[model samples]
Target: MPTRPNYNQSSANHPIINTNNNNNLNQISIMNTNVDITSYVGKVLNINQHQVIVEDVLGQGGFAFVFLVRSSNQQRYALKRMYVNNERDLT
Candidate 1:
């Protein structure tokens, strides 16, 4: 039998998942608290140390909203914001 590869290694590209026994229920809340679909145009978000400016909302789904954005270097990107109300779906 082949040995399983260790995927929990630390890397800049991957987020580390700590399997601790700390159960902080206070931090476990719905991803989207706002019910209204507010436009994020003209707003800047710092993701991964890069500044991305929201241009407009491209589309919206039952649980997600895709926004058209541009990076500080003028690169276009589509940012998807999803709402996970059900805790089971998070797993």
Candidate 2:
């Protein structure tokens, strides 16, 4: 079997509110919110004075990549990118 790259050491921590099961599960939230905005082709993202460029990367054990962008006009924001198998799916 082929080994996959390790991407699980990059996130923060947060408390989750689970109301489904009687058991309360405490999970650690990753803080690896780096995103490569350049990869978002054709996608229009609002850019402001507070906006920052970030690199998209997967946090250790993270299922997805998130972007941490700050807007001068507004507060900080997190931009998430969905991984697609093909470019055509982007549409």
Badly placed stretches (over 4 Å) of model 1 are: 1-38, 86-91
Candidate 2: C-alpha lDDT: 0.36
Can you give the TM-score per candidate against the true fold? Answer: 0.54, 0.29
- Name the top lDDT candidate: 1
- For candidate 1, give the lDDT of residue 76: 74
lDDT per residue for candidate 1 within 1-91, as digits (tens), equals 9532332221122222222212422232234557444446677766544567766666667776656667877767766666655556557
Instruction: Write one digit per residue (lDDT tens) for candidate 2, span 16-71.
Output: 22222212111112234475333442233433212333322333234444444334
TM-score, candidate 1, is 0.54
Candidate 2 global Cα RMSD: 13.6
Instruction: List runs of model 2 lying over 4 Å from the truth.
Output: 1-52, 55-63, 87-91
